[model samples]
Target: MTAPASSAPPLPDPAPYQGAPERHPRRPRHPLDTATDPEAVELTAPVFGPADVDALDADLTRQHSGEPLGERLTVTGRVLDRAGRPVRGQLVEIWQANASGRYAHRRDRNPAPLDPHFTGVGRCLTDGDGRYAFTTVKPGAYPLPGAGAWRPAHIHFSFFGTALTQRLVTQMYFPGDPLLPYDPVLAAVPDPAARRRLIAAYDHQLSLAGGALGYRWDVVLGGPAATWAEEGRR
Candidate 1:
């Protein structure tokens, strides 16, 4: 005799196989594992209008009634991206010690005389061609607190995009500075080529008639030849 099929609602469709739970859930990875990584964290751009920056802000020497004590300098440069394209309309700021190697800050106990007329700070926006210039004095080398070696004569540069988080800080050194060899901060950069990029070149074309000496330094935001940032690559 043939056996009849059991009904039992067709065995409940085999209970839809449930796979095992992930033994080790994969950890999230950062966008920038390496410099070449294509992924990047998007940052909001800062908003700045013409009224935000005063025309006089670009001239540090004229901030006070009298001129600051130091060798007058006309520092000019273009801000560029990795592709060598101009980064127009960005804000560039600079602050440094006076010619005597003394900072205007209260905590700076370098013992050097401070120039009453010099505030040692300036800022300007990049032009359409990405060029920005400042009229100021060359900063003097200052000794690091408790450290035997002295810091090289360099101007502290701060570049800002749309936001404060987009700010990139670095120091610009003059060419042929003897202190360059001993500056621990500059030495922290492992690459020789990258260190050289920090030094500005003398530009006679940009020099003032008999006033400030001119220097040209172009900042590269990223790429193989990008400028060496103080905090590291951004």
Candidate 2:
């Protein structure tokens, strides 16, 4: 059976969670931020509905003749509602920096080298089983603007769910990355377990021997323990 949508609100907004007083981006300390914004709470969000995202879009490997840098990876996951049933027809889009910790975008001034073939972006829709997968190269850790600041390897994901409240934007990290504890962005998430959800577990069973390694990351929407999402209020 299809998962039933939860009436409960999603996990707390990442803005507020990571809005420590000294945060560089400076999360608003306004009293109003604690509560849900009236607009987000009231607006009638539009549903994009089911789409046919090409499998080609999901593969970041072999974008060019030579293989992309870093280890080849297969990220597979399922979309489930709080009720624990599969949420089919959901859209999941991912973008990540190249193995050298540089994004393909022009604004990224990181010293890392960008792979000519690695576009660093992909999108796909969940099947009837609510499963989605992406074939890409593992991102690299990079230094930030601040002194000694560095981000761990991670993939940014945006889930376009059935409703505005269901829509979510979050980052996925690799398992056993020693930097997880120190990364400011990931640290913003308050719940220990919720933070764990962002880390994709190593899955040898799904690995394609002599090919890309595999990892599994399940996403639960609108549940008591939902994934951390972007702050829609702003």
Candidate 3:
């Protein structure tokens, strides 16, 4: 007989992450956000099949020719379902500012220096164990246009599930960041516990000797920790 078929149920439809109405003035919800935007009840088809994503999707550090500046970092984590089961072959995309907290986009008005070797974008697929990793520089904090408005160092993440409805985008923050609690963008997330889940924990064991520090952050698309993917973060 052929190898046994898997018995696990398909991942659950993630609960709609609710946000407090009060955040509108400071962080208005998008007009086409999932809450108000309606689409066909049928599961929207996936743009690409699992086969379309490959190993290159996982290693973002080598996109450029030279080494980026600032403290090097190796970020690692797994994608798991609510039951803590590894969800392999998920497409995960990450982009962040350079060590100086300056993005390489033309629209960025920040005066900080930009690293020539750092495109600040990476893609990777979770392996058999549902694990994914990337190497990058520790981004610095940046000041927003408004007075006393400084955004904490963070990396943007977009994870695509098997279907369009399964997708979610959020940001991952560094631990021990004092700016977190004060950021209006982050504050838009109503639940304190859910907010905490957005931060990645430092993992000395995963650190590179005398080099990059390491961080471990696992993501759960559905289940109890489903609240982890807080809203307000694009």
Candidate 4:
């Protein structure tokens, strides 16, 4: 005879069948969605004028009483949008290690000498043609603390749009830095062409007759050819 249904209580009817637990379709991601993008965050714009920056601010070498040591360089570049339009009146800023490859910050333990004459910081507003220039010394390469690697000579650049949040940051490397291949920071950029974009081109025309060597690096804000930003991929 068929055994009486086993004494185990009927599986509590699956708690009244909560019908497939309400599935909501995920919203499609927009190609241009910046909601979660840190680089797209909106920031308050501060009012700035010519008086805000001293005329001497663009010249890093003359910041101090005497000239800094090392090879003086004249770096000039244009800031453009993806469409190749000038980003006029935008603020362009740069800071880098001194000729000895040592930062002015106290935390830098690179054991390299610091330049009292060179603060390694400069800023200028882009002209109507989106050009910005700086006169600084060539930064030396320095070894990373624990990475067993060295950083090539490079200048850190910051571009400020209408709002502080609209800033984009990149580095300008010398045309021929052997250390570029080993630098983890530069290597992080997977694309070779994009990597090359970070290297400034030598420009003899911009070089001073008896003074600074010249390098030109054009910054493309957003596009297929956009300069690679340090914070994130564009």
Candidate 5:
């Protein structure tokens, strides 16, 4: 006679825990890769605090008086890892002044025409391929906050991904900004080479099927060594 067989308990399904404990899948590289590299100086510290999300969103979504925010200029870009793989579903927020170089905020004090219909805030979410797009007017050149009072035309960008601790804050400069030399903030970026990387290139040929000036700017984030190694193959 065959020996009696014992019944064993069923194994727990892992589907529920798949992405629970781990970071978001959008970032292909590990957090270690982004933190250990000497090249990632600016990325070392978390720029935004946990308490900042609400305030940030409020600022980003508020409506401001401005010239009918010029018909939307489509801004498109990608978010990638140090290894250059697309980082999907990252949150991207953008803000800029109206064509008159005046912000909708009361603090702007530029006295320029405020289009009651136009506000500078916009948001976008990266797709699976790490691509993102949003519509906004091209910000005009404005005076910076200082004795020199000079600033180039630019846009502010904020980003967040699966890793809450790795939020980034940066500015995008338009090409051929004559005042770049006079801008203290732009000059403050430590690495001359990395500083140049922040300036966006203008492309007239990127017009949509309808002939809109499309701007493209990509963002690269640092990650763990293991993530960097994995990203290196591609």
Candidate 6:
């Protein structure tokens, strides 16, 4: 008798997590007021906005070092909206490979230096003013799925939307990466001007005074504030 092949079940489409009150509690008050209130402190949700790239670049550039890039990288950014207002009471999660392009997970085995203290995973709850911080190292540029080429250094971030299902996933690119021109992901932006937004800018404030590079990316989440604010208003 011939054996029959078992068919795999179809994968379900990922649903947009419209964070309803059932899952997340309704805000006691407006996020802005809460953020500004001294007594009513709140954590801001993570949002990637245009200004974030510049802020991140400045932070990293100011803290460069002659030391060998380690497996541990610190990814830090602020959660804000289009209007430049801080959104409080949110969670930020970041994941990236080591300086040698090796992941801590079991599936990765490139043997890059791994920092026991740095698992490439960092989480921070924004302060009452939508500020957040993470202590990681600068990740290394690793090979990609393409013709065995490597991609520029980057860090992945995810946001909690802070209200309803308004989560977002995005990445931050390093400054002056030659691979940016050939990178497929960065190229997807179509418009060169727009694509540049993904690249961080050099800011002196982010520097550690006597360090190699430290990042300070502040991301704006979701569509322009008008739309997202409406959702918040809902």
Which candidate leads the pack in lDDT?
1
Say which prediction, candidate 4 or candidate 5, comes out ahead on lDDT: 4
Candidate 2 residues lying further than 4 Å off, grouped into runs, are 1-52, 163-166, 208-210
TM-score, cand. 4 vs. native: 0.79
Q: Which candidate is the best by TM-score?
A: 4
Where in model 5 is the C-alpha error above 4 Å?
1-72, 208-210, 223-234
Each prediction's number of clashing residue pairs: 3, 0, 3, 0, 11, 36
The global C-alpha lDDT for each of the candidates, from Candidate 1 onward, is 0.81, 0.79, 0.74, 0.80, 0.62, 0.56
TM-score on alpha carbons, each prediction: 0.78, 0.76, 0.74, 0.79, 0.63, 0.59
Using TM-score as the yardstick, the better of models 1 and 5 is 1
Q: How accurate is candidate 4 locally (lDDT)?
A: 0.80
Write one digit per residue (lDDT tens) for candidate 4, span 19-115.
1133322565435346676554343464677789776889888889998999988889899999999999888889899989999999899999878
lDDT by residue for model 2 (1-234), tens: 999985544443444433343423446543333255665533455545445557687898856677787888999999898898998888888999998999999988898788988989998889999999999989999886654657889999988765554567888999878676667777667777888888999988789552679999998887787877755521
With candidate 6 superimposed using the best TM-score fit, by how many Å does residue 126's alpha carbon deviate from the native? 1.4
Cα RMSD to the true fold for all candidates: 23.1, 10.1, 12.3, 19.1, 21.8, 13.8
Cα error of candidate 6 at position 141, Å? 0.9
Ranking by lDDT: 1, 4, 2, 3, 5, 6
Q: Per-residue lDDT tens digits of candidate 1, residues 1-234?
A: 999864432212222112212322356543444356433333344567778988789999889998788888998889999999999989998999999999899988999999999989989899999999998998998888766778889998999987655788888999978777777777766777888899999988767553679999999998899987855313
lDDT of 5 by residue, 1-234 (tens): 998763532222212322223433555664455446754645654354434444324332234443355544556778888798998767777777887788879878776787666677776667799987765667777765434456677887777765445567677887666676556656554445666777776666776542556677877777431111111112
As a whole number from 0 to 100, the lDDT of residue 218 in candidate 1 is: 93
Which regions of candidate 4 are displaced past 4 Å? 1-43, 208-210, 232-234
Q: Tens digit of lDDT per residue, candidate 3, span 107-194? A: 8989999889887887777889999888777888898765466889999888877665566788899998877755665766666677
- In model 2, which residue pairs have backbone atoms overlapping below 3 Å? none
